[model samples]
Target: MRLALATAVVLSLFTSPTMAEPTVKLHAAGSLKAAMSDIADLYEKTHGVTVARAFGPSGLLRERIEGGEAAEVYASANMKHPTTLATAGKAGPVALFARNRLCALAQADLAVETETLLATLLDPQVRVGTSTPKADPAGDYAFQVFDKAEAFSSGATEALKAKAFQLTGGKDSAKAPEGRNPYGWVMESDKADLFLTYCTNAVLAQRDVPELKIVALPEALSVGANYGLTVVNDAPQAAWQLAVFILSPAGQEILASYGFTAAGAL
Candidate 1:
């Protein structure tokens, strides 16, 4: 009896009563930073699972995943990247998680409004800033705006595309100073007189630089963004749970507070 009890104690010492919770690895678009941080915190508190997150341009993040980086979940600023992953069998089905629209961030003294927004962007004297196309969805959306400009005037697309400065979202783009919004920092540094970016990003930029103005794109030029979420193939169960929670009402509320149109609402 004494020998048996000692053996039992040894086995107990090597085994845990409950399995350790898994950590979920999430790669998401930079635009989702503020919202996803809150969601991750809430998920940790409620589910007892830690989340490791990486944020950047959605297209770049997708490229990292395609290149064999270990990401259990992916959230993108547009459906294209995540859908591409899903098509490649790298991830599960894509889901629309959020929506956003474009707006122009202008210098405090710049004269811009919905009525003259196109003219302002076309003016030879104005310096237009944009994210790098194909590497960032914001830049793609800006170009889409330029495409729509063609309906108003011929040769508008080429002219706007030629003058636009690709200042951010590329691999070598300058990093903003610590604790500074990239958009605000760029404007403060006089990188451009009018920068086209997501409306939500514009809001954050304005918060950082109160003097900056956020001008809404005219109805004719407005372009909407669709955010996508997916669970990577072979990801642990915790990843699926986290993805579900992001689509949950509670998660949607957090995103909505940050100016995103929640998936359910759309």
Candidate 2:
């Protein structure tokens, strides 16, 4: 069944496409699922190539490349991470794709605003969850939130740590001390009061979970996170084709519709 499912989903690649396209495998950031998938389908239709995406934390994906997991194109949650991957010889020249901000979000049924969300995370009543800094770019971005809170001063790290019951989050947290993690740890949970993540994640989450409320992040505390794309070692031609398509105007338009901010535009 899994094989059949895979074949059907990737059926476009096996058949000869009009654009002389090849099948490309893409390893992308977890936060990019919605935007990337939307662009991928359009890219396949226009370019006659199929792009298969494997989404996960950027840090771990970089590690996968370092450990020799073969890939073609890599899209990271933050350019810094893909830049780091390039530096470490795991990737190639990366181009900026889109930018997002760190948003403190919760269920609309609650009354947590931006200020209240941050305060609540620090309060004993809130048990915040964030992706692990070592494994996910969201974790690093989350830490940056605290970094901004302190103006990069002392005690910021510890204070951020204290705002949570656990530092580890996402699928990899099974390897962590928490051992059990929720599927969707919204900021306003029945048991907790605050959660932190990127606005990109919220955009994707809204597709299925419409009750999510967005907390307005203060300009002083907010950060613009960039998504980056790069070619990997010895990847197929289809990868390059998809990469070009993503950089094209059509692809950019699709991303913009999903709240992506182009770096060069600013």
Candidate 3:
């Protein structure tokens, strides 16, 4: 995707001795903080602009927009929120920008074998953690994993459900705690015994604490989490420009480098 960008000029009207650039505010997924910070610096240097950012779970970001939050560009860990906004004519059609996967991250010594990840979560001694399902793909993906396991191994499923304590499954699961996904409870940093997070978030969190070990989900149960970005109908002018810039090859390259799967691979 090639975009024709306007070139910059050397102006002496310099209050800052450089081009006075427009600043854009971006609301992004919390898991994307590391990669976004790296990408933002490169973008700011290339385009002579500044990108101010706020990061959190996708669900929180979505509700913010629905309630009339002022964000020109909205990027989420999943495409659904953007699509919901687009359907209501609040945001542009969604563009899948990148993708990630859910992984179980546990203390290094407590890490379980790959083949037993699902079973390990069921063990009473092993406490598993995850994000809020309605608000996070990782949280929902965790439920899918458990439900799939439930169909194949009823006892394991039941035991794990008991251990997990609060899942909100499709219908049978509604009885789950009002805001919790039994298999993967809605958790953030320090919110659970074992955090269920995307690979990116795990990587970023490790920079703060190095004791965590990432456990890959079983292939039969896990699904990839795709991310998307779009321009909100009411975004400010600067936000629009930054949104456009992020859709280009330059932005995709940065996203892909940080363990994200990019668009067009299917």
Best by lDDT: 1
Q: Which clashing pairs does model 2 show?
A: 187-195
- Residues 31-99 of candidate 3 have per-residue lDDT tens digits of 677677777787788877788887766777888889987776788888888888888998765777788
Q: For residues 89-129, what per-residue lDDT tens digits would candidate 1 score against the true structure?
A: 88777888899999999999999988999999899999999
On TM-score, who's better, 2 or 3?
A: 2
Candidates' C-alpha lDDT: 0.88, 0.66, 0.64
Candidate 2 error regions (>4 Å): 1-21, 151-156, 165-171, 174-192, 264-266
**Candidate ranking (TM-score, best to worst):** 1, 2, 3
**Clash pairs detected, candidate 3:** 72-235, 166-181, 166-182, 167-181, 167-182
For 1-266, candidate 2 gives per-residue lDDT tens digits of: 21331233244355434355467888888777777888888888877777878877888888887788877788888887777877877655777877878876566666677656556555555556666776888888887777776754466567876665333345445431231223234332343344567776665544445666667677777877878877775555567567766766777777787777754321
- Compared with the true structure, model 1 gives a TM-score of 0.92
Which ten-residue region of model 3 has the weakest summed lDDT?
A: 1-10
